[model samples]
Each structure stands twice: as C-alpha cells, then as structure tokens.
Target: MRATAEPAIAVTRQLGRFIATSSWLDIPVDVRREARRTLVHWIACAIGGSTHDTVERAVRAQLAMSNHGNARLFGRRERLVPASAALVNGIASHVLDFDDTQLGATNVHPTGPVASALFALAEIRPLSGAALAHALVLGIEVECRLANAVFRHANRGWHVTGAVGSLGAAAACAKALALEEQQIAFALGTAATQVVGLREMFGSMCKSLHTGRAADNGLTAAMLAAEGYTSADAAVEGPQGYAQVLNGATDLAGVVGALGQRYEISRLSYKPYACGVVMHPTIEACLRAREARPDLSARATAITLRVHPDVLSATGKQSPRTGLETKFSVYHAAAVALVHGIAGEDAFSDAMAVDPHVSAVRGRVRAQPDEAVRKDEVHATFSLPGETIEEHIDHVVGSVTRPMTDADLERKFESLAGEVLGASRCGRLLERCRGFEEISDAREVLAAATA
Candidate 1:
C-alpha cells in the first residue's frame, strides 16, 4: 500500500479548544498582571481619544444607526449597544496610536481588539475581573500567535491588527461567554471569514476604523456562534483559508507549539510616545541628543538620523500636513521630540505639525536607513556650528528590555485621562485597574473610566 499523509490538524479548532478549556487559574501570575496593565493602558487610551474629532464624527454616525443599550462609552457620557460601544471604544483606543504593542517580527496592538470586545460583552453580561483577565490573555495569545504563524503578513500591506484582530476578538468573546470548544471553533471561523483592514488606510481616520470594525465583527461572530452558527473547522489553515489566502504561507507550529508553556502577553510593550512603534528609537535618540546640548537647536546646522530601514517604510512622511499624518512621519516625531522635549499626544497635534519651529526642525532633519540597525536602536547626530553631538540608543525606553514601570503607566494614564475624568477620578480609576482581579463586576471599572 502507498504511504498516506495523516490528516492536517485544524488550526482554528485547536486554538478554539485551548481558549475554551483555559481557566483563570491556569494563567500565570505575571501574565495576569500584564493583562491588568493592558486593560489599564487601553482604557486610558480610549478615554484620552474619546473627545477627538474622529471619535465625535464616529459617535454621531453610530448614534444615527444604533439602538440604545447598557454599555458605557469610555470617557463619554453616552451609552450604546455592546457592538457599537466596542466599535467606538476600539477606535478611540487606537486613534492616538499610543496603545501597547507586541514587539516581534509582526507588530500588532493586541489590546485594542481584545479589550474592546471583552469590555463590550462585560457591559451586556456580568463578569468577574478574573474572567475578564483570562479572556484577555487568551485573545492576545491567539492574535499574536496567528500573526507569528503568518509569514510577512505586514509586508503584504495587510494591517495585522485589523486582519488577525478579528480572530482575537472572537476568541476573547468566546472565552468571556464560557462557550464549548466546538462553539469557540465556530466563532473563530465566523470571525476569520470577516477579516477587515488594509495598510493603504494608514495616516487616515480609516486606520482607526480597522480596529473598531475588528472588535465589532469579532463580538458579532461569537454571538452568532453561541446561537449555533456553523463554519469551517479549518477556517485558518484550510486551502484558500486565512493563512493561505492572506499570508501566502503559514507556520502551523508557531500557532500550536508550546501552547501554554509561554505567554505572548508577557512580551507586550507599551509606547512612551503616541506614534508608530518604529519611530520610538529615533525619537528617543533625538530627545537624548537635545538634552545633551540644549543650545544645539539654535546653533545646529543639521540633524541626521541613522535608523532601521523599516522606519522609512512605515513613518517616512517628511512633510505632514495634519496631526494624523504626523503620526506616520518620523521626521515630525524627531523634530517635536527635540523641540518640545516630549512626544506625548499633545506633541502630535495639527498645531504642532504645522508649528514654525517644528516644521523648520523637521525640514533640516535627514534620515538614512541601514540594514544593520535594529528596530529598537537608532544613531542620531546633531550638527552644530563648531561640532556635532551624537547619541545612540541600544534599547528603546518601552521595549521589553526597558519596560515601563507601573508608576510610568500610571503617569501616562493620568496624562491621557486626567483632563476628561479629573485628577481624583483618574487616581481612583488607576487603583481600580491595579486591583482588577479582586473586582466583583468588570462594569465598575468601566463606570469609573467614564466622564
């Protein structure tokens, strides 16, 4: 008899089973702590971005079509259905591009999709903090692992956050509902079929829409599955399925190997600057160079940056006209970081982008890409009248090597949410997030976050 190949294991079914069977106690204490950090960071980002013009327009558009529900819109006074709330909150969390990022070959904002969907579901149904945390860990793990499995997903111009994010949202929602393994598999299948987002949408409001849509779509998928919706068991690995169609190749082991031995959530990195992750090293180097020679700005003849080649592809915009465009401009980030000594959300505004000082500085700054440079490393030099001051950063401030402290996260939260929620409320909200596992109802945290 001819040798026969064993049947392929269904990636979607395997992942769904893992998510379905996993419990809060199975999660590591460190993973659980990171989950709380992810939630706190996401909540702050959502609230901070809630008042943006993009969010205002989005809310208005959603209100026109949505029926009222019990879910609270973070940082706002209005309420919407869980689906709509997820959409809005997801957009808000990412509008500023300041949310946490997973550092690897494939970069995705794991929290935006998972946290957005999970919180929306919590509002509709009661869930303990432990339940919420477990779902979050599983959701991020699935999205990031899938991202790792797909070779060059970003190189093909597919925003992994929006494309793979749908699957993450589905897993989180399925876990939150305590669905059976089969139902969870169906949910992943349904969500996989609806993957949305394109890299072409970068530097526009539509980019944020990708995150929002992923959250809404995933939640909807899980809801349908709970009601006995049926979909392909091999939705992710089947012929012409997500991995094959989207990435052109798949690494099944990356998705399935060491399933519970390591947690991807622990590898998450928060952003100190409110822009693309690739620009962090450049910004950090520029900021340090400026500090070394405060007078360099006035006497400087030129500013030059040597960075990883990937930086230009992602944030190469030299002359950005708007704040949104500035987020994708490495030149603007370096300029503002040096001129203002900070790169917070305020530093990436339309006014800052067009400010005469920032524009002049950015115009003089030049970037050269070197293949040898790492993503988290940058070499920046400031040319002055007499001499040049050079600064090199081996590891960016927010990388896993130099992770943000709890105090740092708290400060960042206050900077983003204090204006909307007031300092006292922000403090309380921070405490509530830190003690997340003890909370009886996740809704209380959401209530505290709202204005």
Candidate 2:
C-alpha cells in the first residue's frame, strides 16, 4: 500500500506573516467601513454598559490593586493600566450582552476582545484610525478563522469567545505594535495557551469576564512577545495544543486558506435586542405575534417556539432568576417581547426576571429544537380561543438578510450612548466613529468617550 503524505501548511506563522506584512491598503473600503461600524457598535455598547454593576465592581477591584496607567474606559473618568483598561472595558462592552455578535464558528462576540485590547494599546501608542481599523479587521479575522478551524460547540462546553478570542486579541495588538512575523507568531502561541471561558458561565457575570480576561491576556501576550517572549510557532496545531486539547480537532485548513481575501468582518451582524442572539428570533416572532393580534395578552394561550437546535443548547433557560440570566432564557425573551413589546435593557433586568406577568408567560413557553431553523430564524405558534395563530420569521431584524441601516445604527448608538455620553458628546463620538478611518490618531476616541 502506498503511504499518502500529510499536507503541509504552517498555520500559526502563516497567519502571523499575514498580520505582520499586511497593509491598510490591502483592506477593501467596504470591509474597512464594516470594521468601523463594528467599532461604533462596540463603543455604543461599552458606553451603555459602563455603569453596569459588573463594570463598577471590576473597576473597583482593578483600582484597588493600583490603577496606574493612561488607559481609558468608555464613559468613565477612571484611568487604569493598559491591561486593566482592556479588562474593564471589555467587561463593560459585554455586561449587557448587547455587544455585536459574529456567529462565525460558535456564536462569538467578535469585537469586544479585539477592540478592547486595541483601544487599550492605542492610549499608550500612536495608533492611527486607519491602522486601528486594519488591525481590528485582521484580529477579528484571525479569531473567526481559528474558531472556524476548531469549533465544536455542539458537544463541547468551551465558550468560543473566551477560548478563541485571545488569538484575535494578540493578533490585533501585535499588528497595532508593528511586531515582526516571528513575534506575532509568539504572541499567537502565548494566546493559544491561555484560551479560557466555559459555556457553563453563560448566565453569570463570569461570562462577560471571559471577554475581559481574553482582552487582557491577549494584550499581555503581545507585550511579552515584543519583549522577546517566545513559544512554539505551531502552538495552535502542535501536539496537545489549543485545538487538540480543547475540541480534539487537528486540521487547520480553515485558518490558513483564504487568508486575507475573504473577510469575516463583513459578515459580522449587529444586535437589536439586549439579550443573547439565540433569543432574537423568538423575540421577534413574539413581538410580531403581538402586533398581529393586539389582544395577544388577553388571548395568551399555549405558546410554542421552534428554534434552531443550537438555541436549545444555548438559551434553554426556563426559569432564569436574574436579569443577566434572563438574557439566556428563550422563555423570558418571548414572554417579555409579547408582554411589553420591548426587549431593551430594562426588559432583561433583575426585576423583570421575577415579574409575575413575565413569569406567567415564561412558564407557558414550550420551546423545541428544529434542525431546519437557523440561528436567525424562528417558528412560533399560539393557541388562541377561536383560531390557532402561527408566525414564522425567516430572517429576524438585525440579521444579515435584514441588517440595521446606518441611520438605524446611529439612532441605536444615540439611544444607548446618549444616556452616558450626553447628546453633544455622544453626537461627536458618533461622528468620530463614522469617520474613523480618516482620523490621524485613534486615542482621540478615548478622549471623546471619557465622561
């Protein structure tokens, strides 16, 4: 028998070379626009969540340990070290679970770690808006591709964002610093070893912390690499490395092929609701059902929600006890959307979790998994008095099929960032982000966001 040889592809170093050698010109205009859009969305979420209790406690903890640096978190006057700032801002961006989501590999939040780490570094470095946008796109691409290469969310407990975000963060930080290919490889290696976050932490504050730690660890990895810290260049695919150790996958064809041609950032989707993406469709369907039947609350009956199989695995919580927990509860989402016709931050509050009306509706939600349903699609049925009401959403709002407009995003940003940054400041920040690619210095964003 002839022995077939294994294909050779240097996954980690190749990625590093792409990151190190790629120029801003290599990124297309639309991709850069989407990247800038992502930054705007991320900043809005960060500012909106800056006052969240999670951010409050995390900032206190980091400051208590000595907050000494020039790094700035969104909508906050407090200054922490670069690494601490990344952690605090990352947590703030995701505390409300309203951060932008990219379902590339395993439903990961694409920009939090990369943007958090990059913004932290920008404060200490002379990063231009174009450079920041380029690095941000590359960072997001690396994590999404790496995740696509080794994702096993169906049977595994790894929170893909925490598990794979470090690589993206390290890549972005390294690019922003202009590290050599070898050093970028080392940064990735360091990040590959520090993959953290578990699906079990989904509903808890630890879930947001996973993103913060990934950003902090990734920034540290790049800094260490710049200072000559080294690791196996093939850390991502080597023996007992991230892929094999975590999901037991070895082939990294997805990570290396189409390196800089097809961008994953353009595919990035925004969130209209403040909860998990898994519940968006259900919420949309429920809200539509209410609109279809104005007397929905009076005619409330046996409700059934058929969603993607992943939805059940991810957001199957029936009796969530807290607002954060409610974000992961499909029942609560459907309940609130139908009852209140709104699913904003207040809809998922700690108080809403225990609301009698919301709970009553939540208790009656019958959720089942359907393989045919996609993450952005939902099927709902309501048993009314005279007739059975059914609504099916092929592509929920904010999905790729029906993406939010730039004006829609602006309004969204204004509503969320306005409360914290105020009308004048929020408008300026929004304009700055809209023209981010032309700015000479990225740190100006930090100054503009400072409360």
Per-residue lDDT tens digits for candidate 2, residues 1-451, read: 7363333567888999999889988888889889888888999999999999989999999999985777888999999999999999999999999887774246888799999999999988889999999999999999888777788444378888899889999999999999999999999999998988999998899999999999999999999999999998678877667777888887788888887889988887899999999899889888888988867855777899888888878888899999899999999999998888999999999999999998998888899898788889888999888788889998888877788889878888999999998999999999899899889999988999989
| Model 1: per-residue Cα lDDT over 1-451, one tens digit each | 7364322767888898899888788888888888888888888899999999999999899889875677898999888889999999999999999998886467688889988999999987789998998998999999998888884444588888998899999999999998999999999999999998888787899989999999999999999999999998788988778887887765676798889889999999999999999899988888787787676566777889899887898789999989999999999998898888878888888999789988988988899999899888899888887787888999999999999998898888999999899999999998899899999999999999987
Q: Give the Cα lDDT of each candidate.
A: 0.88, 0.89
Off by over 4 Å in 1: 1-7, 151-154
In every candidate, how many clashes are there? 0, 0
